[model samples]
Target: MDFEKIVSDHKCRSCIISVERYQDGGFGNIRVVAANKAHREDSERVFNHPFVPDSPYTDSLPQDKNFEDFMYRCACLGQPLHTYVHVEHMGLWVNMFLLPLESDKENIGYCLYSCDISPYADSEQQASLSAETATHVLEISIKLQGAKKDDIRQVFRDIIEDIRKICGAEHCCILYHDITNRKYINFCEAMNPQSPLQPDAIYNNEKFYDIANSFDSAIRGSSCLIIKDEHDLAWLESVDPDLYSLLLENGVKSGILFPLKHNDQILGYLWALNYNVEETVKIKETLELSTFLIASEIANYQLMKQLEILSSIDILTGCKNRNCMNNYVDDVISGKAELPEPYAVVFADLNGLKRVNDEKGHSVGDSILRTAAAILSQVFYDCDVYRAGGDEFMLIIKDGDVDETSIKSKIGQLKEKSAIDTDVNFAAGYYIANKGEDIRTAMRLADEKMYIDKKEYYAKHPELKYR
Candidate 1:
């Protein structure tokens, strides 16, 4: 075959890749057999060297397993293919196509590999998937587009179920990483009713993050991992024996794993186990496009949750802020949230915040506030405690969990423990209420008793009368 003339006929960067075929149906080293002037110039510009024909592809491009797999599938397997993928590690988008060619030698199979590389992703290229893929990906985007953070779990389950069916897999799951907290959150999962694999709580284990992270080496910079047979499993075992053992235990004989990523950040992983191996390319194409949209949705969900947390937390004391307390109060008042037959409302006002702020500084006052909150949290661990502005905190405790005597005893402990961080004291009071008692009235009574306790504290030490 006149491979040079074949490449020269095209104006774009085009080349011929030669694949060594074995009689046992396995492939060997893939080499670049020829390249056009356009391809040569592009290579020279990137590598700062003249393009040398008939050399290993790695001689010009980085050795990538995904690129190798695409070449083998097209040249040896005789499948024409097109791919638009983000090479995230390299910060480049690769829009490439492949077509099998007639080979003159029996031992050597050939393919035409043409590509366009860009720093920014092309919207048109990304939307150029097959009709079926585009339709399904669009459907996924629509489902995610309408999801709210609180309802994302159900939406994710629905999406994962749909993806599992599309892949003909026995089990499918999406696991997200809370990197800042070093935790794993199982977003959702779907298992075929007849699947041999049993449900596992492995993700909940503390050691699983280390096991999951080990897959980075096995993936080796590929867009996804497709493990089809024993050979792949052996490679996986060599890379991470723990993961390999777990996969076999879970009956993961064949699978495809895609990293859900957004803007170069890996948000999580999506995997389908015991999938239809015959549809490997199709699965890859589908997930490559779909996970892109899924990742965006997940990122949005994380952002929403993060904002809520930030808004509801008191930065100085690390307690629920007044806004959160107000919301809870409104819910109870509006009958959106129900209270038990008997409950206690408690008020705790810091005794010496103004003194600390006036004498030591606001920084020290803030530290003292944190210490006071820590004491309250320890004493009322089972109750709902909120910062009710300034140095006052309120707690709503269920009577079944504790009686008024226990509440008073806990408040005393809270005062004693406050001494652990500076000489702090809390003027606290509680009001026990039965059914039909209003929370606002309970709060008023608690606050009035708290003032009485404060007056007694000042009475004991007349020099601290200002408190």
Candidate 2:
């Protein structure tokens, strides 16, 4: 029977090695005579050549002196041998079985069968690994949960470092979603000491979004994506050269992208770059639990921020509420906050809100309030606009020259526009405060001037007064 034919016919990863004895009583070159389909593919990827008749074994394969000695002895003595081998460069652990091929009384060569066994191990080994992985996950969860609100970013950095180490990745990062801007922002990152990328780098430009969209499209409806190398993205490269070039320029040779999701929303993306195959597989298997915990922490952080905003934002006018204004005033009075020079205070009061509320209903009054807030925001886009009272709005502009005449002209235009659109009227006055003057004094002056303007408006339109 032909041993090479027999090895080729096997379903597993098997290769027949022809071992020749030299005239000097030493082993000669080892050559592969035949290999099965699985072994051929593995050889092509790992060694850059498939096993064929008279093909010399490549020197790039990881060398294990003990494994080579065992094969030599098995061929010389015509005995079978078995052992486990670790290929460090490839990050693979495999089981090997070597059997001598003999004809009559002479040993011809050795037939080798190799099977990847990295994912499986003895019961004790499996239990120990599981225990260690569980400990890591628990420790990370505890650290994130107990972290202070101000220290959450640091906690994320620590988590990224841990993930990078666990996955043996060259870099790891979290990309946050900027919903208002429709962009993805790099929130934080961890990188290997030798990596080219920097930590905490922000990516919000058009090129970054193009790359993100390509990855998002490729992994649509999938929980995670794993690209082995550039060849894996042939379609993407063909369809979008800019995106492909961007990724390559950023040193993304191979990586995985995991979306952080809550309910139906994608909160962000978790990225691991240039990890080895074994580590990538391990990460894919174990990351689901850890990512869930991370997503929960992110969601909790977002909720806290939203609560802070809601406490200070006026719902009807979409401006800072009285609570926020009072806090600012207290801060200024207590010397905790310093006002910038050349500041101005603008006071505005709706002219006929009570009449509209009494006759046209509170809904109409609310609409007018919202419209007034919008106009104030548009005119003083660079200043802080606040709803100081039920019918009063205030604006504070700092570090800019006060053009009172121009502001009054804009207000006049707004009055004409509102009068035609909704019969709404508003009166406004501004006071430019001198340096080292009390902010309260400026506010009082602004209010008195606003009252005078209101009186003039009522005198001009007495028929529009409240019933």
Candidate 3:
């Protein structure tokens, strides 16, 4: 199937469905226009499926392109798709698909005619129901839309509980794919009241590991399967007897595995077990939902991860910035349970940043700062290095025995070496923390010493400009 095209079409239909939801929690009827036979069939199947009561397409079919355009506009304006549907009883008005019951997936098509129940039914009553449905649909959309992994699991758990209440299939389990671990991990499991398999302890069983590995291989290969009859369950049982026993004890007779893939690369799988429907068809429905949810979630995850990385990184040099370095400083200074000797803080100020930036350009100045950071990191051990600001750097060297004289010798050598290859030069001074000294005082002392050393160096070499 041309899944991209399918997704595009569904996105369009979904926009319309959202507008319908806002019109009155789908109490009024809605219609969807399909791009092809497959799209229409898929929409209808999703709408009619008994287990998916919240699907947006249960009752509506699109009549015209104008209505489709209208729905898209509403969605753009922030109308959630699951909260309302548009419908006209007299003329061809836009209609949205809706599932009626919170637990039932079947669509009950209702238009203004059906909603216009008895004239005697007060306007107040109609308004109340409309408001209630709108609120419910909004809540459902918020819960399902852009959900995280935890959110997805919670929604599935709620769905399973609802299913158990309606279908008498008290025992259920969901296996969601953990992409990083390359395995299908159980998210939630609902067990029969009389079963010996304790719900809390079932996840700890070794059989879950075997099942996860088996599903991981299949998911990696981009395949989904349904364990329909006793034979399939028995086959899995033979691989891990404990899991089989647990399922059998809990009255689990069927299961469905749905692969989640992006661009033919399987990212994960979702396995639903012990539902009322035949294992095969339920598996198909699950595959559809899994595809939608996984695609949306992976996109969201990638975006969030990128944003997080960017937030912590320095945009210029692509390194850990001041914010991250501060945390590192705090971690080291606030020693472990047992306090040891205080560490040393090295304060460095680049001598020619303004000159480099003014004469050579800011790019060269930035390069010099980056080079200084690299040199300091290479030279120090167990230290916190920071680009304190433009052309200024700081280092927190832990538990070092170096005195003022030795540190000065090291800095002098680094400066002489740097002048040979690069125009970078910096004056550095370090102060070891005393018993009662704080960070600020230590830094102040270091800065003062650095300036003194810089002054003396210029005094001896009268030709060099000190400032």
Q: Please tell me which predicted candidate would have the highest lDDT against the true structure.
A: 1
The better-scoring model by lDDT among 1 and 2 is 1
RMSD of each: 2.5, 11.2, 15.2
lDDT of 3 by residue, 229-248 (tens): 56557555665565567667
Residue 190 lDDT in candidate 3: 61
What candidate 2 gets wrong by more than 4 Å, as runs, is 1-132, 165-168, 178-181, 191-194, 198-223, 228-246, 276-286, 330-338, 403-422, 437-441, 459-467
lDDT tens readout by residue for model 1, 1-467: 78888999998789999998877666788999899988888888877888888988877665776677778889988999999987756778888999999887888889998988899989999888888888889889888988776678899999999999989999899989888888767789999999877646456545688888876666778788778877678778887788788788766798888888887788989999899988888788999989988998888888888899999988888899999999988999999888876888999998877887888898888887888888888888887679999889999997455576788788879878876666478898888888577889988998999999988988887876365
lDDT of 2 at 119: 39
Model 3 misplaced regions, further than 4 Å: 1-305, 325-341, 398-420, 434-436, 460-462, 465-467
lDDT of each: 0.84, 0.71, 0.50
The local distance difference test score of model 2 is 0.71
- With a 3 Å backbone cut-off (N, CA, C), the pairs that clash in candidate 1 are none
For candidate 1, give the lDDT: 0.84
**Positional deviation of residue 423's Cα in model 2 after best superposition, in angstroms:** 2.5
TM-score of each: 0.91, 0.62, 0.43
